[model samples]
Target: MGTKSAFNWVTLWASLLFVVILGFSRLSYGMFLPGIQRVLGGSYGQLGILGTVNFIGYLVGTLCLSPLISRFTDRKQVINRMTCLLLGLTLIGSALSDDFTQLGLWRFIIGLLSAIATVLVLSIAMDAVRPAERGVASGLIWLGGSAGILVTGLFAPFTIDPLHLQGWRYAWVTMGVFGVIAAIGFDFATRKRGVVTIPSQTESKLRDRESENVYRLLLNPKRFLFLITSYFFFGAGYIVYFTFLIPYLVSKGTPSLYTGLIWSGIGFAGLFNGWIGGKAIDRWPSGYTLALGLTLGTIGVFGITTNNLLFTVLGASLIGLVSFITPPLMTTALLRRDIPDHLYAVCLSIATAFFASGQIIGPIIGGIVVERHGLQFGVASSAIFMAIAALLAGLYGLQQRKLEVRDLPISS
Candidate 1:
């Protein structure tokens, strides 16, 4: 197959991997919280703890990944497939859970495996395409999460029955089955054609030099710190909206049907994120692109606080369009540009650890705020976090520009 054709084929299956790992395994949890609560009998605070535990597991997973990959460098594909398999089995375990504790344990395992699968899949997908196309390729891979969201939104309503209280279990089982299918497909598709590698001796020497000083190189850049900090805030901020939006709407007396439509609308808007966000990153500076996305996300979160149905729908749509996956997409693309290819996975793992840390804190803080003040205020907190992230990203952008100018060669 031609290079472009291979890229398309690999990226397609990789995106499907994202759909199962991120979309079904991770994001779908928030959407089913109410049903879980109904059957298990827990306060919002307790349920929120489940989210926190999951992120803690995620954090642990990201931290472990680099070391694991280092030890088993040649078996990266084996690791990926094994993680995918465990993730599916864990979801099945979740479906069979009888209590909050059991469910939380399963969720924790799911988070761990999901984190590994996500980082590996994105790394593979990004490696499949040319340098110039990395932005678009990352966007396409993340777009699978949007696809998962859309499917979950549509499927959630059918599986969650107020009378049954057991309907949500079926959703988990179905997601598990799909996850297994995705794993099988990904293994088959990528078996022959693996990640593109740089075989040049000079490039290998350069990579070796860079790898030795990777930590120093990454730390020396003020912009890298800003980028990761922004990622943390983005993680803390955007998750509140996703975790609470459906529950908040339900509390406001919105019908399940309208809520599903709103949720699906968010997913629908996300369909264009790859095109819009990919083009933005490809053209604009990464810092600027990140800032723009965070700003838009801030506005979207604020719009939800208004609680007007129209505004909420519009807010959800805007978030899905610009912010949902944009921050991480931009972050990864920028890192790929700056870091050596050999160290990309390690660097990404570090960045994702920061992101996971934020996710752990977000749900807990949001839960407290929601319990004390209200869901409106809880939602507003998300906007505040995003606004802070935008400022940091903008500062990073400015710093990057100045560095570029300082390094520019003078014409004789």
Candidate 2:
């Protein structure tokens, strides 16, 4: 195949891999959790802890695996290796289950592998597309994940054996099989593409300098401190709704059919939102767009707390639409704002880690609020954090505008 055709082919398969990875590999566990717990005879506390463990692995993987990418010579090699390892981990998550302890270990490993797959796949997508289209490309790539969730939703009814409802081992195994297929497809698609090559050997002195630079900027108090703080708030709010939306609907006496419908709404909204987000990033300043997205997210969470299903679905859809819209642009914006290409992975990995950390805290905090106060309080509290993110973003926007003005004066 010609270079252009090869690139397109690679994009198609990588997106597919990401969708499968997002859906079956990472997100499906929530759907399977209740079933697993019933079979394992574990308390809710145990189940929640298992989730926390998996998230910790995710956080750690994002933090630790980034440097390895910089050290590798071939992007394709990184993608294939991570895909295979994640697939293997998925199989383990499916097949090995004597007890909760074993299951948690497997789940944690699966999460760790998935973080690697997600970042690599995203990097592949971003690099494959044109600069102007980066946001749209990234958005579409993530929507692959949304598609995966849709697949999970459609498959759950069929794969879940009601007789063996407690352990739904069959469902998990099927998911693992799907992940392997995705990995194989990903490997085949990228095998022939011409792409950017990372050099494996940085001279000893250069490696030391790069390490110092990466840590200096990553840990820079003056640079990303505010961005990190804002994202921390974004993490706390986004996770509460993303993780608990279905359960919250069920608790409110909504029918299962409606709950399913709401999930579909989220997926559908993401499809459109992804396109809009991509376009918006190219046409407008990304920080402004991101602030707007966070504002919408706040509204959505607050609506869910009102006990109105119409408002709740609308709010949930807004959250799904806006949050997914922000990531690609957010990444792109961070890159454009002066972070170098070499340190891009480092910055992103750190951002993801902070995001995961917030996610880690979100569930625990939300759970406490739900148990002690009520579901409304839990959801409402999340809105508060999103509001804070918006406020911080607005401040960032002001700072950026001032910097732009100062630079323009110099040019004049």
Candidate 3:
């Protein structure tokens, strides 16, 4: 196939993979947590541990990403990921023993594979698109994940009941069936038939330099420290909201159905927000866009603390719109710096590690705050971190201006 056809199909598949890996595997866990806990006869502490284990797995997956992608063809890597996803889902669905250890093992595997698969699909989509359009392309790709969450939020009430073991099992089964279809689609997209296939050595070399380039770019450019700092704060703050929003609402006397609806609203809003974010990055300085987006997102986080239904809904909408904004903007900014494609993966991997670190810590901190001070205080606290991110981004914008001035040739 030609480049046009190849890019279109690849983007489609990448979006679908995002839905499967991130939405179904990662986000769905929170939705299903109560059911899993009941079925396994575990406490909230175990549930907390489960979340930690998952993030730890995500961290390790990013660590192994270079080797995993380097060692396999794109087709082989995707297939392997699908296999792992199916196995993880199957184990999760079939469990009747109530063993926390068994559940943890499955959750860890799913987390690891999900991270690897997510990064792989996104990189695949990027490879298909031109460098200049990568921001919009990534935004479109991340919309798939939001779509998955939207669907789950709208339909999951019917599929998952905390009181019923069958509900949890059925949910996993449904996701597994979807995975089967996605795996089929991935294979078709990478098939050897009509299209252009870049050879293994080229891709192999790209994967090889991913790790080395991340550090090199970090030290050499110097501007990225601000970007990295903003990303770290975003990770720490946004996840606190994602992990705690529903519970906070429930604690505030909102029904589960309403909370689910609100979460779905966030996802629906993300569909357009991702587009707007992508376009903004395409036109504006990324540092400016990053600060503005974080400011908007920070307001949403504060809404969570408002304890009013309307305000919370508004907050969810704002947060949804900008939640994944940073990744695409960050990618576009890095690409503009003349960073090579191979190094791109490593750069993302390192950023992902910081993001994962925040994920690991966010829930723990949010939990403690909620337990001691109230859910409102807990949710409100996350906004402070996001605010810090906005400050860093603003600084980055100013620093870029000075750098630009410095790079201009002096008149002889």
Candidate 4:
């Protein structure tokens, strides 16, 4: 293949893998939650606990990833493929589950598998691109989740009643089959590819110096703290919005079909995230891009709190446009830019661990708020957390600006 063709081919398979791992395994739960609850007969609080369990598993997976990769460096591809396959099997297991405990077990396993697959796949994909293009590539990879959300939104809600209360089960089965296919294709596509290496001695020395600087920055908590904190808050905030969105809409007397459509709209709007948000990341500072996305997300979440259908639709669309994937894409791009290629996966795994920790808390708190105050208050709480995330990202941006200014060469 030509160089351009090779890039496209690699990106395509990687994004497909993301569709299965991040999209189907991770994000699809929120869309299917109401249907699952109907069949399993659980309170919102109980379902929220399931979400927490899944995130906890994700946290464990992220924590374990660095060591596992070091131990099996030569077998990264095998690990990635196996993780994806296991995630697919777990989704299928979820479909067969008859009780809440069974479903939660599958979810936890899914989370663990998905976390490992996500970091590995993203590392592999980013390796294919030059540093300048990593931002766009990351956005495109994340866009696969938007596609998953669209697919789930289209069928999950409607499936509940049409298949004699087995719609959710069928949905899980379908997602599992698709995930398996994607994993097989991903394995084939990436089999011959490897991480790109720098060839110039001069460039290698420069990279080493830059890597040392980045390591120092990381060691200084003042310089690196805000970025991880922003990630944590963003994770906590967005999961709540997605987890309860469908149920909240239904509670407000909206029809299931309409709710599905609204969810689909969010996904459709997200289609532009790779292009729009990626361009923003490419042109602006990473922290600024992250802060902008979070600010818009905060507004979008607050819009949903109004509980007005039109406003909610607009809110959901806004969220789809920037919030869902933008923060992580920016975070990854920033880290990829500063961290050495060899250290990329380990640093990203650490960052994702922080993100996962927030996710573990988000659903539990959101459920309690919903149970006590109402869904509106629960969603409003998400907006508040997102607002805090925006603030932290903005501070990070300002800090980056100061560093850039300090590093500039003096002229005679």
Which candidate tops TM-score?
Answer: 1
lDDT of 3: 0.65
* TM of each candidate vs. truth: 0.93, 0.85, 0.85, 0.91
- C-alpha displacement of 182 in model 2, angstroms? 2.0
Please give the distance, in angstroms, between residue 294's alpha carbon in candidate 3 and its true position after superposition.
1.4
Instruction: List, residue by residue over 204-309, the lDDT tens digit for candidate 2.
Output: 3454456556655544444455566677778777666655565455557665455666766676776676667766766765456778888888888877766777
Q: Which stretches of candidate 1 lie above 4 Å from their native place? A: 1-7, 196-212, 405-412
Q: List, in order, the clash count of every candidate structure.
A: 0, 0, 2, 0
Error of 1 at 57 (Å): 0.8
Q: Name model 4 segments beyond 4 Å from true.
A: 1-7, 194-219, 405-412
> Which candidate do you rate higher for TM-score, 3 or 4?
4
Please give the lDDT score for candidate 2. 0.63
TM-score: the better of candidates 2 and 4: 4
